[model samples]
Target: MKSSVNQFSTQFEWILNVINVGVHIVNKDGDTVFYNKMMAHIDGLDREQVLGENIFQLYPSLTDESSTLHVALEKGIETIESIQTYVNLKEKKITSINSTYPLYEDGEIIGAVEIAKDITKVMSMYDQIVDLRSQLAETHKKNKFFEGTATYHFSDLIGSSPAFQEAISLAKKAARTHSPVMIYGPTGTGKELIAQSIHNVSAQRNQPFIAQNCAAVPKELMEGLLFGTTKGAFTGAMDRLGIFEQANGGTLFLDELNSLDLGLQAKLLRVLQEGEVRRVGGSKEQKINVKIIAAMNISPDEALERGIIRSDLFFRLNVVTIQMPSLLERKMDIPEIVNHFIQKFNKSFFSDVRGISQKAMQRLLQYSWPGNIRELGHAIELAFNVMDTGEVMIEEHHLPAYLFPSGKYSVSNAQSHHPPLKDKIDLPVVLEEMEREMIINMFEKYNGNISKTAEALNIKRQGLQYKLTKYGIEKVYAAGSKEPK
Candidate 1:
């Protein structure tokens, strides 16, 4: 039995040493019992020298509170995917993602085993991406003539609806101060436009204005982008200025701020609180004078509920919150928005499209634009592209096919005049007939494919079949076939 146990111990040590990840095992007293070569390589230490030493003594920088292995052993707890950063005995800064779990023998805790994966290279690559983006932003700033400094001022924010005007009123008040502003609105509701207007009217109007979409950047790269990086911080990391430093004495507009990782959000909260940022690899923090304007497609409350935005960060950014109304909320502005797009496309396309017809405008108003102003703008652009050179008006025919997929209002023919009613019309019967007609049209359009027809009509196939039977259109469906039935 003793010989067999000795062989098992030897095999276990061999397996631990050959594994890819770094492994360090410590007894209940926190003395290193097993330290693998991978752990030695990761920490730039000698495996032979590390064995039998007190973990705290080998890496004097780590304490009982900070070291995962020590904490697990002391508390009999497990730590998973905890990011740990510490300077090694050689004074080399090492960053790793660690998972530490307590070991048990005979129902009693004996020691702790820690598994670590060095993420220094991954962080280095993220720093490089941040450096490149900062360089591009700097280049864009220098050539302001080409990029054109945000031309949309407060005057250009075109909406007179009460909800929109109330938002603008709050924004104008916010622009007068250096306090951080948080703007919340649905996508395509011009959140960035409001950010630009705020910057253009702020005390830092002439200073650099930098806008970055948080969602556009990879989550891993965001921290280094917001906070500069320093040399020797990680492998291949170099000294570089982040967006915060670049936009010093100016406004740094972070669009879709909720998309930023919560861990990075804590770092951002620190910057907002201290008005300073330290580079990724550097030891010293630098002061910054930046006006932050954060925009989110989701409401701050919703983001908080989803745990996407940190509560502390949200409270800090909520100093001046402005909720921009969606296009649906301000349908009164659609006509003016449509006209603006028409003029915009006329200049770009060099076409002389005059205006949209009343019927087309009615169609625009009747439809619920889920994409808000951006979708409306796209619809106008699509219409302009299809209009002929001699065509002066943007008629319903010029609109995109997706806008009226049911072909309910095809502009191929003029509006049919209905004869005067002699008595009270059976409204429900008329509506039922219209619904049945629409279902039949969809069925025909999808070539009797029940699945496709049901999907197009936004109904289940079984429900569509019931409707077909109720309308006596069951003949359209073939038995036991995928078609209509």
Candidate 2:
């Protein structure tokens, strides 16, 4: 009898230590018969403390309808997927994934056995990954839409002016050919949008359409970005393809061509002439099948005078030119553009604002838009946000003060007082006059702080002073004056 008891005790201890999941056994009357170390470890309880305790006494609700233990006994079959939370002897709460089934003897239900595993880490990781995937999906959607379209090609262009229509027609025609395309326009005239649209409409639409802003690229990184690099080509590099290689067999639109560094301009010229690119560190020149579409916000005449862009590259790109009209030159498109932005902002902001007030519409039309279509879009978005109710009625006062400044309003009011001058000036002379007046206005706005005014106007201080002298406005500053007056 002693020997038999010793063998049974040894077997039970061995089973307790080897089990991976928590294990518990209960008699047919729901009293605890055997509990293992794994069970105690999972529940954060002491094995000795759980001895002879009634299973239902600890968890009173363990009945046939709700508990797996009850179902196992009633059906005399294995019961799985029972979930329960337990408070260990130390009073700490822990969740367990519990499964129970009948402990059988030949064909009789002797008792029940339960198994559980801790799933806290698994559950936490699952939730985190799910959240990350959702965020990534949203970002991917945004990138896809923005990267696929350029300005004015789709309904987003929001204009139907004669100049705009002409530009689009020319762009569509040029897009059909594989020749290099050049787009000329003033700042904020949606040059990139036209470039992207041409690429999307072209035969190579399925291939990558890479759009790069030449002015925005850092001087040091420009070469590598345009041509690519081999493994360990530079610090922290892992063999990356350049923009030319990435946009192979598709359109590669380089914006602000005037801003390219002069030395790098030679390499670009070669690429245009040869249709091939050599990586920054590699000797082998790789052929690129990319279609080049270069854009400049400055006119060809101004570009020549500035000596910012190479003459050879200009000739290559100017084979086909698409001149995008500025908003000030196409006043007829303002209303349609305004309506489109209002509708777009409404959808994005979940606002019910139907449209703008008549006064607001007139105010938008009257303003001399410096930022063009982009500025108009921003103004509408700002108005929609500041409007009080769901139904936003944009008024003249709701517009940005910069659009209808006090001085500009006064000028409009005094317009009839000053009779129109009978001067049939050439385009160059008129542009010069406009430039002089703008500089004067900027000086006055800055309170004659030359440095601040120059910075605001995006011109060097010396450049501003030179212009002031050329226009004979330096006399105002030379008369021991601290201000422009």
Q: Which candidate is the best by lDDT?
A: 1
Best by the TM-score measure? 1
lDDT score, candidate 1, position 478: 39
Cα lDDT tens digits, model 2, 328-447, are 889998888888887787688677777788877878888766557776776676665545554456765445444555634343332342223223213453345457557767776666
Q: Each model's C-alpha lDDT?
A: 0.77, 0.70
TM-score of 2: 0.57
Candidate 1: tens digits of C-alpha lDDT, residues 1-485: 99999999999989998987899988989888899989998999998888898888877777777888888887888988666677777888777778899999997889999999887676656556666666766775677543324667878778899999999999999999999999998777888888888888887887777788887655645666788767655333467888898888788999989889888998899999999899897888899999999999777888988899999999998899999898879999999989889889889877788898997898888866656787687677666555555678877766644456565544352332221221333355445555765876676666777788889999877678667645544333333444343
The positional error of residue 124 in candidate 2, measured at the CA in angstroms, is: 31
Which 10-residue window of candidate 2 scores lowest in summed lDDT?
A: 417-426
lDDT of model 2 at position 176: 89
Badly placed stretches (over 4 Å) of model 2 are 1-152, 235-237, 407-450, 454-485
